[model samples]
Target: MACSVATHNTKSNPPVTTTGSDSDSGINGNTNNTNRLNELKFDVFESITNFAGNFDLDPDQNFYKNCTNLSNYFLCDQFACKFKTVDTQKSFSSIHFNARSLVKNLDAIMEFIETLHFQFDIIGISETWCNENSPPLNIPNYTLLSKNRNGRVGGGVALYVSNLRSYTQRNDISLTNISCDSIFIEINQNHGKNIIVGVAYKPPDVNSNHFVDDFDKILTTIDKENKLNYIMGDFNLDLLRYTSINSTQDFLNILYSNFYLPLINRPTRITSNTATLIDNIITNSHDLPVTSGILYCDISDHLPIFQITSFINDSFQNDVPIQSYRLINPLNIENFKQDLATNGWDDAQMS
Candidate 1:
């Protein structure tokens, strides 16, 4: 069976609720308010320094003054004033799911993505079960890059990259000598280093040793490119069994030796009796800050996993002015007063 994937965005707004004065509304209203507040707690906090409104009273009096309840007030205040500093770092976000068959769940996947508060940069799918004869799969505002299995019926990998990003398919890397189903693309970032994104799927029936050797060759090729890279997909090897399974241990060892780190530590597939983490997103950029986890979606047997990585531009970091402050000691205060009294006032008067 194939797995399906979906995307997630950072949510900032609180859920809206209606209020009533009926006696019966007390318990339900309170419960709804508590649930909404809990939802707001997970919202991604963003900088409000550049917001084009008065930081003093405009937000409080004009924007949040009419907030219906405590949840609304906290959500508005959190977005409007919680963060004071601007975040200049750029980020790349990607989501991967094993869609056992994409065509059947395309609508559900689209609906799920639309519900996310933020959009992902790349959407990867494993086990697409698509071939040359299959109908074209498309997503709005994204370009699809897929590698379908030739003779097989159930294994394939695909990537849907946002049209806003400039990318080129890496045929040379993807057209390997092995039977691994994969697709590779290079994202060209204007302000930061380019990122190589690849998606692959290894069938459960495939020989572990052969699959690992083939996958390693691909990893080695990308590693030699020496760019920030993320390889995501369903490897069909349970990472939870790393310590117990020899093949799983070898798979992880190869990744670590290649300087790649798997971001997902939890299980991606769960049933009544067993849980397994066969789906993953592994990256080589260890220095960058990254957040990754499995999303609780039930469109398929496999849960969707995602990664959001903040890439710091060295040039931008170098350009940012460092704030240096004078010590507020008595000597500095007296010197400041003496300078203020003695300095020429021509420039100040002209201004």
Candidate 2:
């Protein structure tokens, strides 16, 4: 569960629909757009200093070598990304956001990915505002699975999964009590692990008690399966303040009881007067190491949270140091002497 979050206000202007082109490869598109943005920024900053020398920056040299494998940047002529000869480990990368509406800001979302060069295997979107009749979002290499809010315009949840792996939407969990738009997807990892990723967007108007009860049921249902779980999205509850609100406290109590850990600690939403940590990524996989953090971007009113689910190789054994000396067994001395007596060393010395 590699995840990322972006901030967007719910009350912003109605987002314009930005359809994806046939050429839109999420990962590649981001790289190409980032290269272009860097080029433009370079042209401008170069003019500021009145430097006339052509800026022949090498992409391979400028980008971090360990950020990704070199094969990803093959578009840069012979300057492919240099990679270390190391074990190739698999990982699931994802981004989560309070999109407000997918159709309205799809372009900016793509642009955001480009600017940051974010690589994701899945994207969880909250507040999609897309319904059953809306046109299909045609991103090149991902399939969109969404749950729209009925009879409403502002709430919906979606998961855009990369086509590289097989996945299915899990419909067993009930959302009636939760009072939010939500989605669940079970990703079939190529490395033989199944990861269940759930995204939810709870409106502020919903009754907290009811929300908690419903959320508890959802967790109970998921916990029974015992699969690696990653739940994220805009809960609309400020986790930073447990004492200020009963709902916040109850919500956290349930999480702790189930061994679910909240990965984002910093504020995810901020305004002139307040900074609130409303978005989060929760997980219960103790054996598998998970790394997460907050991404400060203006794609939504809430900051994007990125989490990575990495595969730890179980094939290699760690080497232990050995002493330079050894002790001889006392009981084997007679056998050793007999074996030494049979040696041709004495005959060779005589010869």
Best by TM-score: 1
lDDT of 2 at 208: 78
lDDT of 2: 0.60
Please give me the total number of clashing residue pairs in predicted model 1. 8
TM-score, model 1 to reference: 0.65
Provide the overall lDDT of each model, using Cα atoms, as 2-decimal numbers. Answer: 0.65, 0.60
Q: Give lDDT tens digits, candidate 2, residues 1-351.
A: 222222222433322111222221222224333232122111112221222122222122222212221101112211112111212246666678787778987777776655554457778888888888878775667787888888767888888888786878888765775357778988875554478888988897888778888888888888887567888888877765655678877887677556566666555564433455678877765444455655545666665676765665342111122112222456446656766687679767888
- lDDT at 186 for candidate 1? 94
Q: For residues 78-149, could you state the per-residue lDDT of candidate 1 as single tens digits?
A: 222322232423778888878889988777887777765456889999989888878878999899888888
**What are the runs in model 2 whose C-alpha is more than 4 Å off?**
1-89, 190-192, 313-351
